[model samples]
Target chain A: MVSTARITRQEAEDFLYEEARLLDERDFFPWLDLFTEDAIYWIPIEEHSDPTRATSILWDDAQLRALRVHQLAHERNFAQSPPSRTVHSVTNVQVSPGDADNEAKVRCNLVVYEVRSGDHRQLGLGDLRALPAKCLYVLRYEERWRIAHKKVVLINRHMPLINLSFLI
Target chain B: MATQQATTQRGYAELVEITDKTFRVSSRVYREQEVFEREIAEIFEKTWVYVGHDSEIAQPGDYKTAQIGRYPIILTRDKDGAVYALLNVCRHRANAICRENYGNSQNFRCPYHAWTYRNSGELIGVPDGGRYPEGFSTRGLSLIRVAKVDSYRGLIFASLSADVPELDEHLSPVKEHVDLWADRSIGGEHKVLHPHRYAYLGNWKFQCENGVDGYHPGIVHESAFSTFGEFGIGNFAARDLVKRGSISRGFPGGHSTLEGGARDGRGVGRGLPHRAEEYQARLREVYGDDRAQEIVSNRHTFIFPNVFLFDELVRIIQPIALEYTEVYSHPFWLHGVPDDFNTRRLYEGTRQLSTTGMVNPSDLEMFAANQTGLHARMEWLVLDRGMQREEVAPNGERMGNYSDEVPQRSLYRHWAQVMARTEAGR
Candidate 1:
């Protein structure tokens, strides 16, 4: 049985806002640290399907994620110049129960508006799965919740996405 | 200003009869709404436009939505793995039935009303079927199917006109090129790596022109070539080394192919260094020496209207508007080639020509700028480049040098023929 202490909606919203801030600020290293070591970051090429068999815009495990971060910081990446600026808004936060070990799943809707090299793009209505949208970081007294998985399903998943240089 | 105005007026007249000798198309073709509408009806509707590959929707119940000219189409694979292209609008209200881009579903339920359709496009369920007044039969309410759906070696294409020529007849001379890529995939099964699709602010013709325009490599892509040259990497400056006389240019119907030495005969070293040995090995394994050598060292071919089949992958150009075009760059695996070989091809294609590629950005920049420039002035743009060297072929068609505007001229000549025929019929 899991502990019944549920996180408030306000706390979940704040956590999402902070995550978006980190991404918008281009603080990648810290932002990456938010994910657990075994976490999967996915952006499906097709909507409502398994990413394993089909092609996906992004199906990054830790290694792939690291490689993307490395490439973004690399000098030879021509598209990175005039780096993309983004503002992510998380709304409609809802918490649901997870499968195992006192894990609580949180789902929220997200809209990320990004601008790069004079092109403005809107990525709307994505689902984010976090153990707890808010981070407690408990030292000793209680166990803290952190993100175990973050899957973003965009409304226009099949649309030809331009260079996704910046994190959403 | 008066002379310029007169020139513009004359240019519009001149554009209506573009020939094989002309290189620059008249701005009217790209801007005139009348021409755009005619093209949609006559050319797109009459021709076999590539929709998607067979591998995209492999299993039963898998479907993808695509646009053909102005009409939305749903390409789905049935339980038996047969592909079908159906009009996306619901039979009831003409509302799009499958709103999502792609998914696996036993049936498609329209969000507007509860009207449902099976993946095979059958009218499966209708909410409150009894509510229909009297003679409404669910049996006759199926989705409108495209006139013809045909596959050429796994690449599927559909036409709105039933009177259009058969797929093989329309493909005509370009069938060899299609086979070259598709045959490499085992049993004619080629899946797209979910191409890097993006829209460029240019006419679709620009992309077709760019596909066979060998002359632009040394100029428009100077930055990319120069970067490679500076790094002392591949023979980026080998343009002069390629045997100009060895370049082969031919037209099969509206389609054209240009096979020549890359970078002036600097040889088959333009691709990624890591995959060089594997590619050569695979080539040798498949076609032995001579054919593999030809495939590796040659330039690209343009399958008229909008398909570009290069060494590694194919790009299908979908015209969205007069000033905007969407290109889907799909990478395919060559049959019998190692998985590593396909990966290398995918990597090279993605890094160089995909939406986010280094060279593609520059190409898009030039295309956008060209579109902007065309709309800038009222003066006639010259399509007369290399007209002096055009030679009349035995078939009455004209031909030009490898770097000449022969192909573009051929394309527009066909375009005019098709448009004129449609107008005459009307």
Candidate 2:
């Protein structure tokens, strides 16, 4: 059985910062380890969507998440020919108790600034785009905190976007 | 020949060169602002452009907004269930009357002057009407209606010029294929769900060429297929695509298709492994086994100028400029199918085609590269792949190997023909 301990706001904030760091530093392999087996990394088109029924920007299970990471890291994946460099800013962490004793729900505002890393300063590839999002995370503790679900709703989710190949 | 003479007179004849042995398109076709402007004037404005599906505005007052070239259009189902395409601009001050993407409104009141118009584009109420002159009349001031509007199998199309051929003439070559796509639903109706809207930095024609060009999938989407292979998610034998009988076809009016070969009995439906049996069973009950099997075979149908009907979704391409285009991919639900079936197809469609999906981003990346590369001094790009092996079917359609540029050749041929014609029929 998992421990029924209350997760503090600071602890949840710290956990989010580490996850954000892993993504920003492009350490996707280790970032993949932070999720539970059944965890979902979802970026929904609408604020609330039935992932099974409705379309999303992304809805990845453990298997798909791994595939995405592999594809990003692959040499021939020219979409990331000069892989995107991103800086994730996570703020306003508000943690609350979840329905399960081992779970806690945390909400925060996030801004991710992404740009191409190399000399390819083409229009779509070079622009420093900012993705502002309202994010929600459900953290569960077994031995340590693991993400059960992470939902990201971009401020401009409904608008048309460019290549979002990098992790957001 | 007459159209070519007219285009030559206008000094635009050198863009595309065609001979018995070779077919070539100028790089300027992808790089020039003048050529882009002429395309909007000569091709998009004169051809039948897809607007929205009939299912989108099924009820009275239901409406959706769209674009044909540079013109903004509103497609509406009026009180009598008649569908019409009207310019979205207000007749009075040139302000747009309807600003929302979609809604059910019997009347649209212009925000600038509160000039209200009925769903059918009749000027119903002009606020403070007494201030106008006595000779003024609203009769000629209704929103400008598109010259031609028609549909085939619930896919609506509008043309700015009535001088164009009837919609059937444009769609005849691909009507049977369209039947197969629409008949996936037992009732022959499909619902367009919300779309995954995205844009790329490339010429619009690049997308038009890419959709039907089957050759690029092996190289462009190698990463996606490899990832899928690693997970054992689907049987993505990209190498066996040709031996499996996949084929590319080009019709006369620029429409094209990439059809799955017969060797893959499950066809592209392999994407949704769990729902295939039940879905095929339901299809067989409605259509006989042969027809059901044909319907099950994967086909990506590109209907000339704007839209693609493929794999349980409709992808629309909108051109913004010489090197800017927007795409909308809407995964659709078939009528008379189980929710699970629709849901699974939806997931598969969005998984590979959405803005952030593994497959399409690679294509978009290539589009950006192609746009950047077109600036080089190279004069021509080759479209001669499979020219020797391509065959003309009894139906007058051209067929070639799965990796052939037959579809691209057909697109440019038709584009050249359309670009040569004058609106005045000179």
Candidate 3:
């Protein structure tokens, strides 16, 4: 199910990289602009599990995503007082034929090395974490490619996960 | 002054000091390795620790692995359809038999020596049995079953002590609350979905104590509710119910609950999307309007040692070390409910409970700080809030206001009672 028309491999890789860069640099609102209003951001609880019947690590509509972004930017977010810093190394972008026209399923692998430091009250300090996931993106081309649905299947989905308050 | 007890051994009187008027817990209980070890021996081994829901191992040969105070155990259904909890340690060589977290297998073969055992706990193969003596029988070598196993409304529990009380007796105290939560469904049935688990550098008791802690929500999650209020996302009015009007109760055997009233039913009933409305109608049809109203009330339940039914999520807190805890959060889907309604439930469950969840990470930060800060000279942790307002019920449940410390007292008192005994009761 390879998408050979309308978009090229290099274009898709560039989009993924730019998205990762925005997240790494904490350019959230612009990153938020990258998704369509009806976008669904999902991090599945387990690989291949139905988010409708099963819980995902994150299942946010645009409304909840905005709330999340607002929390990260808000001053009183004690969970992010020191704030988590992450570098997303996104790779292996492959475009497949999606179920609809003007939309294609894009697949990529990501490893986000995150560190939470400067925890004076000892809330979250000296903590280094890793988030590895196989991300599936359904991109719809309007003026440019916008994320219609982004589903992240974490490798350590079943393991006890720590906070991912920061965007990845 | 803090008790002079050594950090390696905890005495009964040093850890907890419970009086009729007030209660104080030692910081050592949260920090000391000795108290943690004793807690594992007294609290986890003797109590009816929740293993997994019966629905998790529904089909024959289905299995899931869990831990009980460092003992790796597996809950599996055999071909005959009987549920069993067996220690995952291989009897032949003490190596782990089944390493996978969840799978369907007819037999578990120890990878070290290929000591194969039936999923039913029968030692079916020995790889080479002729090397042993004729009297060295395999009959006594089946995987050791936990001393007791039973279920209360699909919530499975196991005890390492054979003489521990019946599951019904152990669970009778919190059965009503559990029923209230479970009966919200159309069939009084629920299925645990795929779990998201992660470990924090904190004690398991932090999770236990936090389960029924209604007081910290407004203070700790200020940012979360700020946006909730800002976005008009949830029932923002009900967010302050814990601080203003609510009830925290303590039951026998260390079980406790924070009945934060019918105000914040967003996670359960309303203040949600269109799907919840239809779901509520279906629930009302099954349970009538009044009973449905009662069922959908938001509740925080801590079932003694291991389980916490927090809102729509079932969290299992496993203590791996003195300062490390692994928590597994499982969202439940009610049977016969509409797909959209369950979808909303799953969405709300993850938004608050997952690793990247806004609410949980805040609580985890406090717990981590609490664990880290206990090494200070200020050793006594005060749990004296709302102590004088206790109203005891006929069933021995002590009730207090929303911000009351009744749960902490109840939990620590029971912990003291359990640790006071040197051996598991017969």
Q: What is the TM-score of chain A alone in each candidate?
A: 0.77, 0.95, 0.92
Q: What ranges in model 2 sit over 4 Å off?
A: A1-4, B1-13, B263-274, B423-426
Ranking by DockQ: 2, 3, 1
Q: For residues B352-401, what per-residue lDDT tens digits would candidate 1 score against the true structure?
A: 57654545655665576577666754445655656787776775455566
Pick the winner on TM-score between candidates 2 and 3. 2
- Top TM-score prediction, candidate number: 2
10 residues in a row with least lDDT, candidate 3 chain B: B263-272
Q: Per lDDT, what order, best first?
A: 2, 3, 1
Q: To one decimal place, how large is model 1's interface RMSD in Å?
A: 6.5
Which ranges in model 1 have alpha carbons more than 4 Å from their true place? Answer: A1-157, A161-168, B1-24, B186-188, B241-252, B260-288, B377-379, B390-400
Residues B2-55 of candidate 2 have per-residue lDDT tens digits of 433333354555567877668888787888787889999877787899888988
Query: What lDDT score belongs to each candidate, Candidate 1 first?
Result: 0.65, 0.85, 0.82
TM-score of each: 0.72, 0.95, 0.94
Ranking of models by TM-score: 2, 3, 1
- DockQ scores of the candidates: 0.12, 0.77, 0.69
Best by DockQ: 2
Docking class of 2: medium
Tens-digit lDDT string for candidate 3 (B294-410): 677778888999898866778898999988888888888777767766777777767777877878888888888887787674678899898888988887789998778888888
Better of 2 and 3 by lDDT: 2
